[model samples]
Target chain A: MTDSEKGENQEMLDVFFEASRAQDPVPGSDLMARILADASQVQAGFNPAPAVVSHPSAGQPGQTLLSRIFAVMGGWAGASALTASVCIGVLYGATAPDTVRSYLPALDEQTAELDYSYLGLLDETVADLEG
Target chain B: MMPLDTNDDISDDALMVLFANGDGQAASVLAYRHTGRVLALALRMLGDKAEAEDVAQDALMRLWKIAPDWRQGEAKVSTWLYRVASNLCTDRLRKQGGKRASEDIDNVPEPKDDAPSIESDLIARDRANALQAALETLPVRQRKAVSLRFLQELANPEVAEIMEISVEAVESLLARGKRGLAEALEAQKMELGLDT
Candidate 1:
């Protein structure tokens, strides 16, 4: 098209294009509502799930104090072993075994003498034996 | 206290991120901000308000879905919406049997009696209807280029991005499309009050 014709055509089309702009439709309220509802629904999936926080020092949140103590003592096995040891100690103390007295120095003036000669044998060198 | 976010100043890109992070207010703000333009473009493309509304809603819905993966600088959210709405309109246009839903310009509906009756308002409405009718005559790509470039008042490069074509290609299509529109409406010029 000639430049003159082109300018004329553009001018004419500009009018129509302008009218089209003025005529741009407003979306109805229902449409806006639907759009937002869709957005919200889709966004529902986007929310990061709340982090599961474990308190390091709080043990288990719901466990009883006795249960926590049991856990600290290594469950039932440790508790049973501790109970058995306490009972054995009580029996030995009550009965006053000579075997127990043999290891410890006497509370009275008399003492259970421990031999140092046996320790001297342990100190003897393999070289002395070989010689 | 942090001031309540009017979100008026927030860019659409940031709004999309907030939306993805489950900020309902951000979604609300972005939806209101963009859906109108998207609807307008779809209206131009499909030439039917209901269909255009459907296209707009679908585009935003896709935006919501894509928000989690939205690469902030890759494309503006509004530009992305335009591209999505344009593509959706294109799909529907193709399935339209290569013919407009309203085939005859003669059948363009008269304004409702309940509508505003100002002379200028009526004139502008008539002219728009005529243009819309004429637009449906060109090929889909031509129509899209014309709508985005002229009626929607988007820059050439932005149109290219939306159409996924080069700016040069967009200019060429616009040239041809305007020519086609002028020819189609030339016969109706006097009726449309373009004789001025």
Candidate 2:
């Protein structure tokens, strides 16, 4: 189209565009309330209740880090099992218990060979066991 | 906590990050700023206040949902909103499969005594309604293009981005849309007070 034609088209449409734009909705209080409500509701999901904790920051700042960890670990029952596991670990480490190694007697073959000579242990041990 | 009023001075990207970080005030600030812009576009596309409001609400809801993952500086809040509102309007228009022809003539504010003649206000309302009527005659894509380009006053590149089409495609749609609107308005120039 010629410049004049384009100008005419734009000019002609300008009046209508102006009028239409003037009547553009202002988003009334009710509409605003609803939109804000929806925002809050959806944001509620993004920032959920503190108890369904997603991160360290999601819990109460007043609470100790240890308590927070316990809360995250499923409360008293988890803490109880965790406590038992810790006690067992401390006992095992302090005493260096060998009952488990005694049960897995075949492991003795490897440990015994590593201590002495593999050929002497394997042959002597095999012969004695067969006899 | 950044004060919600102070958030007005902050960029939208900052506000989005604040919102993602669980700043309740940030949501309020963002909502206060962009809901009207989104609603205006949806209103033009849907041609019904209630439906447009619903679309606006849905669009804002989506923004709230995506807040946690809102990568700052990657996309603008306004552009993202316009794109979302435009798509929601398209879905609604397609589902309706027909023109939505109501404009709020009844809701036009009562003319004040100090204002110009009530007749002028009436003329302006008539022209707006007529333009809306003509807009309804457009294909949905053209209607969206015209609304985003002309009514929303967005640049062609931005319009293209919102419409997810090439710049040339946006130009084509707009040219065709303007031509159609010009022809429709030409037939009613006298009624539109353009004959003066």
Candidate 3:
């Protein structure tokens, strides 16, 4: 089709399409009501589930006090464990001996010879001069 | 504050704010106002009334669940609901292996007429069925654009927001979709003697 013809045809088609769309029916009222009811039921079912609040009178007085104490003790124990872990880590980092040098005997001898030479008391130096 | 008397009088954003503040009535009003439109959109997209109803109900349920955390003015509530419902419908269609092709568009009974010729009524039914079939054959996005713009009477920007596409994309989809529909209906039009 030519451009003008295509445009004309498109316009006609648009008219028909719009008419058909206008003919489409709206959804029924009962459906909306049902959906609303279902949503309300869902909302009611939520409501934070009432948080399972424990009434003061619901538990025995002695059990409540014991539970409170246990909770506090559990928290303190967790904090103490964490602190102890940190302290141990710090002490190990600060005071641990350098075993890396002790692992190699050759490295220890090289260090001793270097120290004697620095003090001007090397036996090798005297022997070389006499030769 | 006194409760809003009319659902239409209150904007969706305002309703969402009230719902966020724990207003059950506001939630109900919002649900009642938009459920039908969302259900209809789902029905047209999914081509099954029951599934559409399920999607609508599920969408509203989700809205209520999220109402407490909903931020007002962030988005239109209806637009949000449409997106959710559309996504749900798309999921259902995918899971069902796209077995929705056998929609009852063919069985859309003609309007009753006492003084009509059988041939004319048959012609009209054929035309309507052809249009429905053509619409069904388009890609989902194109079909959605066509339906929302023409059928749901939503504007371009609103359709864009609901479809989560740019306005230009919506226009492109509608243009291409209409061309495809025109081509598909051309043969049916010839059969119905309306092509000329």
lDDT of every predicted structure (CA atoms): 0.83, 0.82, 0.71
Best by TM-score: 1
Put the candidates in TM-score order, highest first: 1, 2, 3
CA deviation > 4 Å runs, candidate 2: A1-3, A52-131, B103-117
B-chain TM-score, candidate 2: 0.90
lDDT of 2 at B146: 96
Give the per-residue lDDT digits (tens) of candidate 2, residues A1-131.
Answer: 89998897788789889877776767678877887787778767776686853675467869988888888988899989999999999998788658767788899888777755678889999999999
lDDT of 1 at B132: 91
Give the DockQ-based CAPRI class for model 3. incorrect
Q: Which rank order by lDDT, best down to worst?
A: 1, 2, 3
Instruction: Encode model 3's per-residue lDDT on B1-196: one tens digit a residue.
Output: 5366554688877776676665667866786678877876776677666677788888988887787678778888888988898888778877987565565653352234441667765655555456667777788888788878876788999999988899999999998988888788766555666556
Model 2, B1-196: lDDT tens per residue? 6677854689998888887777778878888889878987887777777788889999998988898888888888999999999999999998998756466654342233443667877786788778877887888889999998888899999999888999999999998998888877788998677876
The per-model DockQ list reads 0.41, 0.33, 0.15
Among all candidates shown, the one with the greatest DockQ? 1
For B29-61, candidate 1 gives per-residue lDDT tens digits of 888789988998998888887788899999999
